[model samples]
Target: MYGVNTYADTNFASITLDNDVFVGKDNGYTNGLYFSLYNVGVGLRPNFWVSPLLWTMPRGYAENRINVHSIGQTLTTAEDITQANPPEGSLPYSGLLKYTNTHIVVGSRFTDWVSTSVGIVGPAAKGKQTQTEFHALIGAEKPMGWDTQLKNEFVFGFSRGRAIRVLASRSDTMDLLAGGQLSVGTISSGVNAAIMLRLGQNLRDSYPTVSLASSRASNPIAVNNSWFVYAGVSANYVFNQIFTDGNTFRDSRSIDYDHNYNTFMTGITYTIGRDSSLSFAYLSSFSDDDTEYSRQTERLNRFGTLTLVWEF
Candidate 1:
């Protein structure tokens, strides 16, 4: 007999020519458009204390932007590029880039201690490349001692083609994420926090090779493989009834730093009404080194989001 939803504030920013990341001198406009949606359908049953629930969230965005510069050039074909030898000489180049992603999930809870979910991630399209993913998860919350709640969850997935291959092709690709969280004190009244950790692996295929002799062999260059670990903590607060709490702060966003890696995010949310809310968050990417490959570097890009909700 209830429903909820939200949308965050839109943002626009200019890319300064003095930005340190660019090789030479460059200038352009960079912007991002993001949105999210969630819906839940409940069915009452005579024998159950809680109704059977079906929930789904479809969220994604498209970024239409460009970077014009005098520092980079385009390779006409894949043959012109090499893993060991990248393009040299400063040549000006510019083009349009676009990307989009969607996720459909379903699940139900038995009693209040256990729940399960399974979902298929549609293909994520970027320019001429596309990728797909699938995932399954199960979690439980059990009372431990007098005031603590023990929470645990496990998830697994399989991906193929350019989607999984793209990240695997990177020198710092880490695949697979596994972790759990634990909390103490009441969850509805807020004032609780939990820590989590995740580990990843990079599965890179071998490059083409040729045999020089009966016992000697030569192999062509390929991308590098790597392993990574991530850790973080989060908490929430409520000033009204748990479900109808509009003055509560919460975190409800996912963060992924391309190429099989995880991110740690810390943020707060404030609900303005039954159909309105606002949130501000800071996320940091954790990696093993500052330099991964020659073409990319590990630099922290900070983000702040203000969200508003409307329900029907």
Candidate 2:
């Protein structure tokens, strides 16, 4: 049976920041910030609303369970934000503020996760103010299209996934992990799979996969002696995406949602001490031909992720 402290290494608080600035571009998933708490049940009770979701999944004898809670905001913008009304078929300005709770079960070589979220979309998410003020501070052009951003609406999401360590070096200095995830909800519906290779010290203490979305749970490393570099590739087939599909229950600026995407990510992680670590990764995404929506599909989507985690 799993012990109460089976996941003590993951009892942490983290903040993640993502932006295109690191890649020298400034549109399409432009910015995001998130704060998260992991292994909440270790020191505090899980949120009451997340209890029912946990009840649905029975625990296994060899697995230990934990709760993760996260809150975040993300912004997406048209290619040209200087225009009060972006060109026809261009990506629309959109914002999301969401809170998510995840149930995780960890075994010796495999981990499973289920998550749900609720969020507000459109002007209520403060996309306009945040971007405009940020641009001014950076001496960049003020964005001018928030007036046409997605309308106010509530969105919900659910996701499930699992990761497995497919191979490991006899010396425990390297490992390979394969993972797949499915998501369904008003925010987006998609399936994605990825494989990652990690090489460095204390590979066993590192998180298995890199998240496709920066606003979601990301790579978390435990312990002060761990350091590694990892690279991975993932393919996604998105059936629906609110940022492109627009408002779920109302008429709003919309575009033909891109259906396919391939992404590559590489990064390095270093633990600063028993309680803290830093991670930085670069991601580049490519999509197959879709509608001529401002020609966005032909361009590469690039961004950088920076994360800081501290264990209690």
Candidate 3:
């Protein structure tokens, strides 16, 4: 929750799950698991790598600042995972294991975030084992082509963005927010912007970071009880995508990926007490203009997210 301006100094933890199963699909970004610690004493020392950004933190009006560390894994596969060798021009199998650190600042009506992540993709990420075993446990069809997945590669990424409250209803029960983000790295590179319309109570208790910014969870700490339902849309321009572009250093399964797309999402959040919240969201994507890769994997782009945040 970056724009609350009066947030308390407390620690929080969260778990987020993203899966296509809820939408009755089994391939293409099939599953994701993430965990985060917010404002906890992780003792992140300032170093040459991050000092400049640290110096940029706004003063005076900036009322809240928090550090967040997160670790997560995401899995993607071709449309047909059961095949020993998937068809040509389909999504390739890949998995990512990532750890990120984010610096957040909240001002009178604006929130800003700067984040960096390090990760690996390929066998080292254990995408094959995680997916196959989970499927076996659930009695689902096993994915057989992980052997042909992307080769191992290390990835580094950085992103910075800001979201601001642009409008609010007289009663303070409805608001509209907008923001833009830019990212670059070996994993992927892109720029995106989104607008969200929210309706609920205590709208100032927290900011919209989850579905709006593609972050995994909302703020865990709240000033008081709060709840909201939101719908949002984002447009993106991707310069590169390692998953569909194949291994960064080696030739491997890959596709002529789409470079532009849009996402639409709707969700609701409910606060329990003043220190916990649960959220559920459904999201889907589409190419701005019909493209081969987009058309091929169109049905595989819908997914759902469930996140729980609580005080530590």
Candidate 4:
């Protein structure tokens, strides 16, 4: 089990400062704040659930993802802000800007080397009701060579689904994610390395995903509790706009510029009792166009993550 520590790395929760696409209720005025924000998620992972039917029958998971951002100005009420438009860079950050999501998934072993999972997602923000997501995945993992301490084997797997939204980023809600990760040690304890390529024919084109930033959310099948300090990098050739004003995929015209970017991430985790653990990570983005750059120099574009997890 694990969670991201946003304050530790400001870049982890940066919000988009788009001139348009604010409060879902009123796009003309934006509640989207500066890039610095925080995100926290908690979930219970797959535990042995079905043994009678097929031995390694079922493993289920449930989680809630939350993003917290600073809204602007004390005097600028929601009604007051609707009348005037803030300039491109200056926003009236007043209260807390937030996005909340809940997700659940269940998986079962199909064979000694393969398994499958299915799940649903529900997201809500500022009283806005968004669409729910349904997804299913199939995968396999097995040991490589025979070494005692390095007894753990290399793992290879792939998944495909529709509406698989990894992060709150609107641009990230792709039709599928088709990549995997590798651990030098065992899954629980190890120096890990991973790469994921985002693929999609359709974009959800929602507010937070497209409006605030272009970065994708956490990758699927996260590292287990045994992992300590680990670092990884990511690069993507997004066919879609990394950031947009409103419509999502079509919000911006077809352009090849600033479509490719990279991310560098590292984090440490600590275990709690026998079933739970907490973790923190620092992530940075390298791109010509990213939400990382903010007019509020006081607010560093530092990125961070905190997550908490458990098993029943």
TM-score of every candidate: 0.28, 0.89, 0.90, 0.33
True-structure lDDT of candidate 2:
0.73
lDDT of each prediction vs. the true structure? 0.20, 0.73, 0.74, 0.26
User: Which stretch of 10 consecutive residues in model 4 shows the poorest summed lDDT?
Assistant: 143-152
lDDT of 3 at 90: 75
lDDT of 1 by residue, 1-312 (tens): 011110222221111111111222111101112332323222211112111221221112211111111111001111111122223221101111211111111111001111111211111112112100100121212111111101111111111101111222244233221222111211112222323332332222111000000000111111122222333443322221111111123321111222222345543333344343333334434444343321121122222223333334
Candidate 3 runs further than 4 Å off: 1-7, 40-60, 208-223, 296-301
- Candidate 2 lowest-lDDT run of ten: 1-10
lDDT of 3 by residue, 146-236 (tens): 9889988999887778888899887778989888888888877889998888888777656634322344433222234777888888888
- Please give the ranking of all candidate structures by lDDT, highest first, separated by commas: 3, 2, 4, 1
- TM-score of predicted model 4? 0.33
Higher-scoring candidate on lDDT, 1 or 2: 2
Model 1 bad stretches (over 4 Å): 1-30, 43-262, 292-301
Who wins the TM-score comparison?
A: 3
**CA shift at 16, candidate 1, in angstroms?**
23
